[model samples]
Target: MSTDGRSAAGERAHDATGIAVEEGIRSLLLLMPRVVGRAKKMHIPEELQSFSLAPRHLSLLANLVFEGPMTVNDLAARLEVAPTTVSLMVGDLSRQGVLERRTDAADRRRTIVGIAAAHEKSVNDWLGGSARAWRAVLGPLTPEQRRLFVDTFHAYERELG
Candidate 1:
C-alpha cells in the first residue's frame, strides 16, 4: 500500500532499526528546518548587521571560528564552493574589517583568513546565541545520549561523503 508497494512496510518493518528509522526520519523531518532557521537567526552578530553580511557570510565566519583559519582553497573545499566564491566572501568580510587575510609564513602564496580579533566580542555574542539555542534544544538529553546523537550525525555525514 506504500509508494514502493510493500504493503505499507519496508523490508525492515519487523526490525528494531525499521522502527527507529521511521521515528528518526519523522523526528528529523520535523526538526531539521527549525534547527537551521534557529542557526540562521542565531549566527549573525548585531554589530556586523550594519555591514550587510548575508547568511552565507555568517556561515563562513562561524566556520572560521569553529574550524580555525584556512587558505581560500581549503575553505572553498570545506564549504563545497569554488575558490573564487570563497575569495569573494573573504574579500567582502576583509573589506568590512571582519576578517584578516595574511600570507602564510611558510607558504608565501597561500593566504590564510580568520575572524579579526577586534570583532571577537561581537562574533562571540553571535556564537553565544547559537550555542544557547543548541543547549536549550539538546540539554535535556543525558550526556551519553547527547554523545550518541552527535556520533550518529557524524556517521550520517561521513556516509554522505
Candidate 2:
C-alpha cells in the first residue's frame, strides 16, 4: 500500500497507461481556469456590449440561433431550466430588443421566441467564435468519439452538481 492508502499495484496499472487519475486531475485543474478565461474573453459585438449579458443568456441564445424559433416551453426543455425562468429571460431580452416574441399561428395562446432581426447578426457573431472553435476541435473526431467527449463533460458537470 502507498502512503496515500492506494494500492501500489493499482497505481502501477495507471502509470503503465501514462495517465494516472491524479495526473489527469492536476492537468484539468490547471486547464479549466484557462479555458474559462479564454471563453470569457471572446469578443461581444459592440451592439450587445450595453446589454450586459450573462452566461445563462448564452445557452438560451445559442438554442434560438441554431435551432430557429421555438416556444418558451421548448426552450425550457432544451435549457433544462424551468419554464418560468425561460419566460423571465425571454421577457428581459424582448424588452431589450434582443429577442422577438410572436403569437404562434398554430396555437393562438402560445408564443414563439426568436432573436430579433435587428440583433440576429450580432447574436450570431457573438456565438460563432465558440461554435467555430468547437467545430474545429470536434470535427476530426469520429461521431462516437465526439459523443464520448460530450458525455464525459456532462458527467463532470453532474459531479459538480
Best by TM-score: 2
- Tens digit of lDDT per residue, candidate 1, span 107-138? 99889998899887788677657666677979
Model 2, range 1-161, lDDT digits (tens) per residue? 24577876566456464686666677898999999999888889999998879888989999998889999999999999999999999999999999999999999999999999999999998897788899899999999999999999999999999
Model 1 RMSD in angstroms? 4.8
Which portions of model 2 show Cα errors greater than 4 Å? Answer: 1-9, 12-18
Instruction: Give, for candidate 1, the lowest lDDT window spanning 10 residues.
Output: 1-10
Which residue pairs show collisions in model 1?
Answer: none
Residue 128, candidate 1: Cα error in Å is 5.6
Q: What is the lDDT of residue 84 in candidate 1?
A: 97
Q: Quote model 2's TM-score.
A: 0.88
Highest lDDT model number: 2
